[model samples]
Target chain A: MTAYSATVTVRLKEGVLDPEAETTQRALERLGFELDSLSSADQFEIELDADSEERARERVTEMTERLLANPTLHDYEVSLQQR
Target chain B: MTAYSATVTVRLKEGVLDPEAETTQRALERLGFELDSLSSADQFEIELDADSEERARERVTEMTERLLANPTLHDYEVSLQQR
Candidate 1:
């Protein structure tokens, strides 16, 4: 088995409204930072041992689909690296 | 002013305990996926108009320092791109 790390980035779907990100944007503007819009995402980095990089990403993708991200409201991307 | 986007990534500082990540890791293990460690992060992408890329990053760094991330327990990175 080879050590690997997978990074899964989850974000609200394009049509989904994100109140928290909006709130954060307003806070930044209140603090004098100039920004037009803001979007937020959650990133999960998982370390595991797998026979190949493909296997590692496959498992991590399953994890994202199952628990890390909500399919109805979110979209996710997975990137893998050998460690 | 030119359109730009800044992505700020925030993650727990080393030595700090991350219960949510731990719980997620455990859940993955329960589902038969083997992993060594897990970590989580928040990413904020801000779209704005700025005089220059440097100026944009400056404001976004302020945003990260003030509201997007808590410096006491989190470490953050900033990346900028022109739109």
Candidate 2:
């Protein structure tokens, strides 16, 4: 089996209210920084053994669908590379 | 002025403990998914107006160092692009 590393990025869907990003923006402005807007996301890096890159992607995709991301609230992207 | 987007990714420092990721890994395992390990990070996308790309990078770097990441416990990366 080959070892693969998958990077899954989960982001809130557009038009959704992101309180965390709003808070971060306010904090930056309080520190004298200027910005139009800000958004935040969660990224998960998974290292696992798979027979092929396709299998690794499939497994990680399933993981994201089942646990890492909420279908209603998040849009996630998965990228993979050999470790 | 031009619009810029900065993506700042903050991750736990190597050797640091990540309970959230550990919990996530166990949850995935409970669902019959197998993985060697999992790590998690936070990513912030900041949109702002800047005079130049260099200025955008500088501001985002400061934001990362001052607010987005804890220097003692987390490592961060900032990537910038025009919006």
Top lDDT hit: 2
Q: Against the true structure, what is each candidate's TM-score?
A: 0.96, 0.97
Query: Which TM-score values does chain B get in all models?
Result: 0.97, 0.96
**Model 1: interface root-mean-square deviation in Å:** 0.9
What does candidate 1's lDDT look like per residue over B1-83, in tens digits?
99998889999999999999999889988988778999999998889988888888888888788888899999999999999
- Model 2 Cα lDDT, one tens digit per residue, B1-83: 99999899999999999999999999999999999999999999999999999999999999899999999999999999999
Report the lDDT of model 1 for residue A64.
Answer: 89
lDDT against the true structure, per candidate, is 0.89, 0.95
Candidate 1, residues A1-83: lDDT per residue as tens digits?
Answer: 99998889999999898998888888778887777899999998888999888888888888889889999999999999888
The worst-scoring run of ten residues by lDDT in candidate 1 chain A lies at: A27-36
How does candidate 1 fare on TM-score?
0.96
Instruction: Show where candidate 2 strays beyond 4 Å.
Output: none
Question: To one decimal, what is the Cα RMSD in angstroms of model 1 from the true structure?
Answer: 1.0
